[model samples]
Target: MVKEVQKRKINKEEEIHISSSDSSSGDEKELMLKNPLKWWSLQGKRNPTETKRITLPSTIKLIYVTLAFVPRLALYGLVFALGQCCRAVAKLFCSSVGAPHLANKRILYISDYMPPQVHGIALRVSQYTKYLRSNGHEVHVYTCCVESRARTSFDHPTLPFVANPFNSGNQISYTAGIKLAWALGAESWDIVHVFYPNALGLFVLPACRWRGIASYCSHHVAMDDYANRYLQIPGSPLLQRIMFLLYNFLYDACYRWPASYWGDVNASMTQTFVKRHLPLAAKYSHVATIGSGVDTQRFQRRIPTNPDLLWLWCDSQCASEREALCKRIGAPTNAIIWLMVQRLAPEKDIHIALDALASLAQQRKKMNKELDVWLVIAGDGPAREGLEKRAEQLFTNDKNAPGRVTFLGAVPNARLPSLYRAANVFLTCSRSETFGLTVTEALACGACVALPRCPVFDELYGHVLPESWRYDADDKCGGHLALIDAAQAAASIEASAWLEANPIDASWSAAAQDLDRQYDQAVKRGKTKYTSLRSYVQKRLIHLGRASLLLVAFYFVLSYYWRNIYCAAQCRIFLPSLPKPVRALCILTFIIALEWCHC
Candidate 1:
């Protein structure tokens, strides 16, 4: 009776919306208001007859540029000399604070992203730190603070920042170059693992070389996919073609120049990465993928379930809390919730999941299964407003009236496990992931997954999950057809109880052990026992053969063609500059300053 009253109230509201907005006769008003995206097409949000883009921010020209490259050699030389002096002083007086004993080494985890930022990289670093500690190694994390809420999740020092203009400030760690350099000069570590090659990596990796520390990286950014997304002027393919040079420069800067070694073992995967992502593959690429891991213990807690079954797993408190959550979210008591937790970015392709939901709703009435499907999207991003409106349109026919889709804004990571467990199936349409950490987290929480056809997904979960778990989709129609198939596959996973049979083996200890093994090998090879002058300069320039070459050519060209720019007073323009001998001698000295920076 109460539900009928609620339904009457919703119907009255719908009638008002139909009358006020559409201006159609009473009958057509109901029909028109039901399909929002279609209504949007009619209202010029999108026009099917003519190609029109979603109203977007004015395109910014993001072309990468290099300026005054040659003239900075003297600055590079002075910095290098000062760095050498600092390293010498650090070694002479500071006397290595935490000395490494046999097998177990003192490790430093350096990254631009860590907790309070809330992303995959942050989670990875936190998990690695925790597990590495459990492995009896002393591990410390140095990263930017995104908030001041007093993070009990992980312990570290404070002072501030890491910024991501690329990700629209989603990942932030900033003004930390000097702080990190100071740390490197003051303390010592066996290994420093950088999670992202943000601006900090530009010189920090070089500092690692100067200090005789083994610096490693875990590659997370997929720039080839990212470059095309951001570095373009809409409706100008010609300008975009020119922008490829910038793309190539950034790819080299971010992926190639940053680290000496990264974790990756698949040779075929490396070749595929080089073929697709690289502008030009380096002749020497390291391949030893230790692989990323998930903390199973974090997700093993039982979510609030039925009171009758509370004793079987969770206590009465969990049941009470979960009931509160369901009531708060307006979840249908008997409905099968398909939860998706991710930042609602366009690249995530959430619309596909909505289309899939629409298809499932129709099929549920006709099919014998009679699914009570609900989609709960827990996230917040720039795309949230549009997605919410579209989702409302998609679930317009939901008998519950307020809609089957729930938009839970910006859920904290601490609450994610409960959401994962309460959810029947974890669904995602993201094809741009370097590593889909959420998928692993969902699996760890015992929720089955439905993922898009992505290479990284295939490599990581191909063997881990059943054949039906992953599906392919079309760009023309998005993932409507394919995600329905994925949903059906997920139903099968639920029925067969696959998660019960095969538990995931992504323990952090195993990952730490792999790092320990790599460190042992590096130490055996006599890495970082001493920081020398020749080795410090030579190794960096040699490793980045092309940057070294570019640096050399830049200085050479400036000295040859643009000599007067540097030596205006030294050169005599009919006695307006120095004598030929003095000028030549000064230019020679200028040429010599470029020596330390290049090969």
Candidate 2:
């Protein structure tokens, strides 16, 4: 009875053990499915009796299983644990700081062009860089030496390339990447901010990755629209198609690839641009909608000297230069000056403004009103000659058309504020503008802007600008009529009063602050990614080292058993007559086969 009771107790204990082990295994499997990284924990807590009961053919099989499975389990566990720890630390830090700390950042700016290149992007970059420097940040620029006049400039050597076929002024360079990398290595830059994804900017992206540096890129131009409209190789459709494909490929390589691979922060000037182009902004981690900033204080309203004399501010230094400009393009002094400060390019749709001027003159003449109107086009481009010829043709029939239109080739940036002050109205007919910098400047200078009703214009100034200032570009007659009405309203005291009441708040200081926030976020993200990668590598190496030790132990165990079996075989079995060296080699081969089969 006592023996039977002992047997029953033993059976009950065994049953309990099996049940506990089964439940534990089930829980582990479920956990593993949820997170494979937790699999290592199962090994240490496994039933010892279960391990003993599981018989294998050889030690080699045991070693192979350990090498293949155990290391992977440990590696996963280490990586998962590290990741969790990092996340916890990050949360704690963020809770403490309220906002990420941003101060004294070493910023590197890479661009294709900077001022004295008369474009919106160049001006925007210059303003941002200047403001960044003023705000106690170390800022450096890397760009082509093409035509820059900045005293403290670093120009990357470049190969000539025509960016826009319609305008010679759009010529840029493909910067040497190797040279740029060397330059970057020499500097201890904290952040690399690329203005536009041209060759110089694109080349530095990989280098940023190699050096473990955070990178950012700002989308400035609509490359596809520009290419489709302007990159025309006339008389060859195949060549045109090829060129189009090439340009698109270049765009993708330069812009999209760098943004994905190296960029910690990607930005666009307008919310419209961010929404449209970078729909994957959330997926990329950091994206910002920081628009261009204007020097509102510098571009303030200055009282004109004469109300009757229409002032056309173009690229002229003095009275003699202005007189020569007037003579070259027959500009009237007494008429209301309709100022156009833009590059003379087809993309600008300067002809629309010219056509509007001609129509306004005809309407005034028919109404028995004084046709005292002069159109002044400021800035120069490839289309200037053609535009001048078109202007001459429009005014030739009328005997009193000597001072109807004039071209002020190119204007100095310093003189723009005074020019804005002098003009009654500012006009633009650009179909594709990423951000209308000049328009903002004109508005800040107290001149009412007469802009066509495009998406960009509507987005920037639709709500802020008065109804009379906005015009329908699609409607030829109505658009021109709207332009005329806007011009007339600009001359009124009521329009000036409205502008004063609703002052433009697009300042460089605000934009710089927004950028500073973006930079901090980027740095935080970059540090997190770098830390995760380092932890993973270190854990993998540790796991690999543990697996190697198991293999070494298995080798020694196999050698010991083989020697014992070989001696026995040699003395009493098949290999007894064979030479010692040959017999030893045969036994070693047999052992390897057995090991392979079992594994």
Candidate 3:
């Protein structure tokens, strides 16, 4: 009775209600195996191996475009463009945005969008915003509300959007650029932080420079995720090339563009980011490992319960895969409780989980044993329908099956902590994860995890958990059999026994503490930089003080000269008030003057 009560308690804590979904694990593996750079080259003929020189035609085109813009507009553009070149100098002069240690520093937090979007990058952005603001930094977000499948109802009130380009196919980015310029001028910001070099970030970059604000770029993902998630399909090679160029351009902008760092929070993701961008990024910038952190307080274990033989799976792509894995493991019905929590996406490879479960049922039938198990699913996704259809077909066909699979879709994040507490084990079947934040959350909740040996699984949890808690899909059938054997052995060894044999509470606490320490260190580092910048900017201000009057006079003279040229041109074009030869010579000389100034 005590064991059952303990099992029930663990179930309540760790039970994850995931939605039904189907995705191909095979496809995911294939995509993972390919070298992203080579694949990138194949898709767009981008020469990652060689330094492609910018052609004179491109430079000429840029020059001509600059000449076409109004002189005042051009001046603003030049200031912004020049700022990119002077970021290191600017940082030497003023505090960069998001650098810790400057009190009351106004930070312009630029990102594509914040959560509750289905995208991992978006969620990370949201978390960063939340933590930064909570820490008392004055932060603001500017992002495009583009029509995407992932956007949810969560809004960062402090970080409000100026506009959303969800419907209009027109160039929405241009409008954003105009708005960004206005924002930069309106506020006194210490630094402008661009999270990614996407459309929005690229657009506002110039505005940051024109304002003489220190800027930063956070390379948050491996460059490959962009190709796989956004640039899908074999065609669109030109777009790929353009993206690569833009990434390179942004890389050149920041004083120091930090890659997601390994051995930090989201260590696996940081490591992956480094691996993907190191070839291109290492050349120009100091690519350091600054990883995203988790709020351990929010995810920590709330109640102590004896660990049940709980199978907690999250990933909308895992339904079919989970079924297949259960069949392989031959877990009896009612004996095992398999929980699947995940998004419904083809990239997630969740169908493999379902398929694995179904296979388990077939094996149970052959043995003439009732598989006493419960499969619970939680979450929602795009592939919900197909996955549901599959679960219906598979389970209905199995007459001897004694177990039932339940779907509990889309629970609140607050509710998830309790679910983690109830479960004994966590399962992740996704082939790739930036860091698998949930996996760590489960670990925090004291749920042992089972996953393919992802970078996170291998690096973060390998030493902490038993060998039975992990498996690799790449391994042969024998290897899988070994995993099954280990899992079965682990099941008999009660959670209490496991805990006694391998103590991890101290390690978990230490890891969490270490994360906090890193956060402190980051803040300290930021402060030092900010102080240096403030001092430099103050020095520059002093130098400018002596020449302020002279510069003011020089500005008026330049403005008047341009005004006269504009009036003369207007008179020539609009009225016959000016002589033809005089108008023509005036225009020619004006162009020459503009060209000389540009030079």
lDDT of 1 by residue, 4-46 (tens): 1112112332333222233455543444557543333232222
lDDT of 3 by residue, 1-599 (tens): 11110011224312322211235445433442564322222221122112222323334533553454345354445554554445434443444622553554456666654554445556666666555655666666666552345433332222222222111111112124443555565545666666553434434544544444555556554444433543322346676578566645644342123322111111224545454555445553234444544446555553323247333333332333344444533443225655556765455556666666666666778888876645556676445545666666667556665335555667677766656545445556765565666766666655565677666456556676777666766656523433343334333447536744453342333432343344445344444645577668756864675467568877886676667666766666633677755665676577668869999
Clashing residue pairs in candidate 2 are 315-410, 315-411
Off by over 4 Å in 2: 1-103, 146-149, 153-167, 183-187, 235-239, 278-282, 302-334, 476-478, 535-599
Model number with the top TM-score: 1
Ten contiguous residues with the weakest lDDT in model 3: 1-10
Best by lDDT: 2
After TM-score superposition, the amount by which residue 431's alpha carbon in candidate 2 deviates from its true location, in angstroms, is 1.8
Error of 2 at 386 (Å): 0.7
Q: Residue 110 CA error for candidate 3 (Å)?
A: 2.0
Please identify which of the two predictions, 1 or 3, would achieve the higher TM-score against the true structure: 1
Q: Rank the candidates by lDDT, best first.
A: 2, 1, 3
Candidates 2 and 3 compared by TM-score, better number: 2
TM-score against truth, every candidate: 0.67, 0.65, 0.56
